[model samples]
Target: MSAQLLERGALRYTPAGVPALDATLQHAASVVEDGRPRQISFEIKALGIGAITQALGALALGQEAEFSGFLGQTRNGRGLLFHITHLVAHPMPANAL
Candidate 1:
């Protein structure tokens, strides 16, 4: 007799408010023995003080600005991992800061 199987999708969460820079700077890890489990980490880095200042200035002027990017990772089993980091930023309201 053949048995039927069911699969479930992954779950995710996004916290409200800005994340800490230090927390975002740390490396992350994951482990799995069954199925093809995947773990993803995300972070944002400001290119320079000028860029960040400009973004903040835009917010003060009642304009909105946004920056975004991605993070990549690969695993090969002998305790080694590879990753490509990325960052993004959005101007918050002057009062929000």
Candidate 2:
């Protein structure tokens, strides 16, 4: 799904030395839910690991893109988090919505 890149924390590493980054995403869109169209908005915690982590670290603030990933609980907390496996740079105007 497409979302705005909200923030990226400093790069971190796993014990295996895999690069990783934590961040947040803000998504707002009109979607069909239960039949009718509805506007939805929410925030989600996100993660980028390996080479993707460095890629995410270079993104400019407010950049938007579509990402492919899975969801899971935070490493040491409670909340849904998106584990980004791949991303495509879209660069849409931040205020276009």
Candidate 3:
């Protein structure tokens, strides 16, 4: 799904030596639910592992992109974590940033 990059944390390594990155993402979309158009927006906590950690850390704040991943619990079993495995940058309008 496509979403805006909200925040990114510093890259850190796991105990097993794999790189890890954590960030927050915001998603907004208009869809037809039950034959009615509606707007939906929400925020999710995201994570990238290994080589993807570097790429994720490079994304600018408010940048929009399509992310493919699954949802899981946080490391400490708090809120959900979006475990992003792939990302494709979406070109935005000149003023969209």
Candidate 4:
């Protein structure tokens, strides 16, 4: 029933070369039906490297970010969350500006 700081890490791209940001947010809450302890996990991603960096910076500063992620399920106790991801300023292509 208390707010818990989950996990934090730098954002990076996958094997496909797509940029992304990752995060895991954990929280403890009372069960809706059984009133037992519950845990939540949050995974976030960004489409571009710039956006992921910006978001990570914001999080480091302890600022509230608009990024999207997962919310704990009262029943299943797990869920998947997706974020639209933001681009920082103008995202330049791989070739050139």
Candidate 4: misplaced stretches above 4 Å?
1-6, 25-50, 68-78, 84-97
List candidate 3 segments past 4 Å from native.
none
What does candidate 2's lDDT look like per residue over 1-97, in tens digits? 8888999899999999999899998899998989999999988889999989877887776788888999998878777889999888786675754
Ranking under TM-score, best-scoring first? Answer: 3, 2, 4, 1
lDDT of 3 by residue, 7-87 (tens): 999888999999999999999999999999999999999999987776688788898989999999987997899999999
Write model 4 residue lDDT over 1-97, tens digit each, in one string: 1222234556667777765655443333345547756655433322224445554544432223344433333224464443434422223235542
**Which regions of candidate 1 fall more than 4 Å away from where they truly are?**
1-37, 42-45, 56-97
Provide the TM-score for each candidate, comma-separated: 0.19, 0.87, 0.91, 0.35
Question: Candidate 4 lDDT (Cα, whole model)?
Answer: 0.41
lDDT of 4 at 87: 20
The residue-by-residue lDDT of candidate 1 on 22-59, one tens digit each, is 11122234546477766644332222122333332222
Residue 28 accuracy (lDDT) in model 2 = 96
Best by TM-score: 3
User: What's the candidate order when arranged by decreasing lDDT?
Assistant: 3, 2, 4, 1
In candidate 3, which residue pairs clash? none
Q: List all candidate RMSDs to the true structure.
A: 17.2, 2.7, 1.5, 12.0
lDDT of each: 0.28, 0.87, 0.90, 0.41
Q: After superposing candidate 2, which stretches have Cα over 4 Å from the reference?
A: 92-97
Q: Candidates 2 and 3: which is better by lDDT?
A: 3
